[model samples]
Target: AALAQGRQPLLLERTAGLGGRARSLFARDVDSMIDNGQHVLAASYHETRRLLRRLGQENAIHFQQPLSIHFRFNQRRNFPFRAWRLPAPLHFLLPLLFGAPLSRSDRRYLFRWGRRFRQTVPEQLKPLTVRQWLDEAGQSPLLEQLLWEPLTLATLNTPLRQASAFLLYQVLQKAFLSSAATSGLGLATRLLGEIFARPAEQFIRQQG
Candidate 1:
């Protein structure tokens, strides 16, 4: 953003690379590139997308359409959850209601949970953990195990018992209820260095 505003911003990195935690390694033996960790982005990451666009590397990230998630419980059982091309909330809500691998009772519980989330104010959530919030909101055990637990762990990198309710609530609002496009999943098609770090370095040098 500073670069876009005609300000020469100096970026200082102690590491040899620019990507920090999100970087890749090139193996000379196999001539293959490997990421340090898998980094997935949601369309709700507006600032990230904007920065990529500023670096002219938007196409380096490949985005999935319609926000589909495939969950494999077993070799024989796979559940696919796909969002509709509808408006905000409905796009995600309809899928949870009808298409997700949830039982009728689970769906009802989820609906009630959604209602409670909608009514909740951010300030009221600071003192609670995600597990406590879910229990208070009457989240079904099945739904918590199958969906919320995994999602919470993936998003917060913390167990529901330890994760903050307010943090999870903000993520839910952005990914599920913001807009149809906000839930789209983005994967970097190129190496992390090529996609972001190298381009950013070049941009900075050019500016300097």
Candidate 2:
């Protein structure tokens, strides 16, 4: 924001790396550089995408359109989660209806909750935890294990029992309930050091 306002911003780093917590490391055991953390980017990450665009590192990320993912339950079995080309909600809904290993009761409960979710505002869920919200929504243990738990862990980086429901709802609104294009999954083509930290540092230097 400071740079956009014609100000020369001075970036200071306490550590030697640029990306702070989202950085890379050289492990002697591996004999190569590796990311300290794994990051999965979503198409709904508008601000992040904009920043990468500004850094001229847009090509460093690759997006998978039509929203396809494979979740492995065991070495022998996996679930294929693919969204339809339909509009918002339906794209995700149809896939869940046909592809997911959900019981009829789970489906009914989810549909009811989906209606309530659309009607309620983010503030309404402010006091609730993700686990509480799911429980109140009549989410089955199987449903929670198959979908909600993993989704919450991946997106919020917080355990379901502790993560705020409001934030999870907002993520659902933006990443899944939004348009198909926004729901697509994106991944960095390179390591965090090469794709983000190094490129961002170079960008800042060039701006000066």
Candidate 3:
């Protein structure tokens, strides 16, 4: 953006790599590249998308359509949760109501909670633990195990008992309730180096 605006921007990397923790390494034995860690981007990551587009590497990221989740519980049991092509909140609602593995009672609880969540603001949430908030919200144990716990771990990198409820609420609000596209998952098809680092380096050198 700075380059486009005729302004010079200097990016300093403390480490040898540009991506920092979000980097890739070649596995010579398999002749393939692997990431240091699993990184999935939500469509709501506007800044990241903008940067990728600026670097002309937007197509390097493969995005899933309609936002679906497949859960493998065991070797024999797997559950598929698919979002419908409905508008805004209905996209979230129809999915959880009809597609998810929740029981009737669980669905009812979640529906009521969703209504409450829409009405409440993120700042209004207390600094309670995620587990405490879930309990207070009457989240079912199955729902917690199947959805909330995993999401909490992935997003906050902390256990639900330790993660802040306010932060989790903010994530949910931005990712799910914001828009249909916001919830779409994007996975980088190329190595992380090819996806961002190499292009960024080239862009910087051209600017110089």
Best TM-score among the predictions, by candidate number: 2
Q: Model 1: which residue pairs collide?
A: none
* lDDT string, candidate 2, 1-208, tens digits: 7766789887787787778766898889989988876777778989989988987888888877867788888888678998888887888887887788888988887777767767887888999999998877778898888888888877777889999999999889999889887887787778878888888878767767
Predictions ranked by lDDT, top down?
2, 1, 3
User: Model 3 over residues 1-208: C-alpha lDDT tens digits?
Assistant: 7887988887777776787666777779889888767777767777889999989999999877667778878898777877677776778777878777789898898788778888876765667899988888878888998889877876666799999999888778777667777777788887888888888889888987
Question: What local lDDT does model 3 show for residue 168?
Answer: 86
lDDT of 1: 0.80
Superposed model 3: Cα runs more than 4 Å off: 1-14, 26-32, 125-129, 153-164
lDDT of 1 by residue, 142-196 (tens): 6787678877876676789999999988888997677777787788898888888
RMSD of each: 2.9, 2.0, 3.0
The TM-scores of all predictions, comma-separated, are 0.82, 0.89, 0.81
lDDT of prediction 3: 0.80
lDDT scores of the candidates, listed in order: 0.80, 0.83, 0.80
TM-score of 2: 0.89
